[model samples]
Target: MPATDLVTAELTLTGRITTASNATFLGSIGDVAVVYKPIAGESPLWDFPRGTLALREVAAYQVSQVFGWNVVPHTWLRDGPFGEGMVQLWQEQDPAQSAVNLVATDHVPEVGWKHVLEGQDESGQMVALIHEDTPALRRMAVFDVVVNNADRKGDHILAMTDGHRHGVDHGLTFHRDHKLRSVLWGWLGDALTVEELEGIDRVSEGLNGGLGRDLAELLSAEEIGSLAVRCDRLRLSERFPAPSGEMSAVPWPLF
Candidate 1:
């Protein structure tokens, strides 16, 4: 099936995302900003472990929903012109704004990192990153730790004009073993706030419901169980735990 048949709107390819492991396109579904990945003729650079990218992206979106953060909109998996691929609601970010540029001069206010990467969704339409110091981002950091996100680079963060920080490029996540790597180290040793703790509780509780069912299809039983185990360890430790074992603390830079 073509992308149009699986998706609701007509897709117009704006450009290609050459930076990704797979061939991705920046397109619009009607008026929505969307990222399109085609499975056919995928780049050979993606030689990581099996089920690595898709599983990680899906898990990240699901966990973001549980934590109530504004993650990139994940539409559905469908058959596209290239092959089986995933479609995501596109995020519009100002070309001039970046977390890297800002981090040099000022600190990201408590929980306000999400709002810094806002931009126009489509038609050059602008949206502001909603800025508020809350426990939500803290919780997200914890989730990243548990899942072992190895690519939380600064550029992956899109800061909206309104101040909402949008996280992108979650393809490197949810390793069965510890593989967490990121640049959000400001809260490494900070204790989990009450709200943050509650969010983790919510994810733990969600595993038995829709979240569990969904993960069962994409991840192995051992992987799913490991996710729960990480949460438990985080809860018990009450702070960012030190890295253990022989795995590298970061991913090899593809660039």
Candidate 2:
């Protein structure tokens, strides 16, 4: 669908997403479906400034566009039923496909996936956290690093039937501090491919041009500067970074 169609079309709230920490709704405009999160529905966050979650989501999409990876679905800010908020085109994911999974520790696949960690389930069975080692998902992991995403849970990744991995719920991102909690740690310590570095380069260079100008509307100077720093750091390291800071490397209730 054209970008303007979603932006201009009439937005109607069809259902509430009760599970989201912030107010979220499933909505539609004619035939186009979308996910909506109004700014007023945002809860106060200790680390992040209040009422900016929607903006950060839009910023993540902005960076995704620069990467040309479509890691985040097309997202933007607009006036909705409640007030101004973030709106993103809804993508129906394939139920059978999953980029990340919690599987029996003994049954962990020997190939096609990367092991993250092992822990016990609610029932006391040992399970391993793993994600598919595909280019599509790896691209998302790299994007998460560049954005300094603070939350990268498994449920946030949508596995499309055509092999595309779409990541959602990007409110906790682009912090001036290093709060990169995520479940995509499978590639930790791995050297970045040439293409991956090129993506980072594009974002870093764009910071001086159009992309940077676009982000200025949504982020503070410190946040935008932090974004540039992340890009340069990633490029220099040439590999996935290990978790740093006092924050846990992975999010709670990971899925």
Instruction: Provide the TM-score for each candidate, comma-separated.
Output: 0.76, 0.98
Candidate 2, residues 1-255: lDDT per residue as tens digits? 677777887899999999999999999977889999999999999999999999999999999999989999989999999999999999999999989999999989999999999999999999999999999999999999999988999999999999999999999999999989899999999999999999999999899999999999999999999999999999999999998877689999899
**What TM-score does prediction 2 earn?**
0.98
Superposed Cα RMSD, model 1? 8.0
Candidate 1 residue runs with Cα over 4 Å from true position = 1-10, 41-48, 101-137, 246-248, 251-255
Q: How accurate is candidate 1 locally (lDDT)?
A: 0.64
Best candidate according to TM-score:
2
User: Which regions of candidate 2 deviate over 4 angstroms?
Assistant: none
lDDT of 1 by residue, 143-214 (tens): 677666777766666767775677777776666767776555556566877766777787888888988888
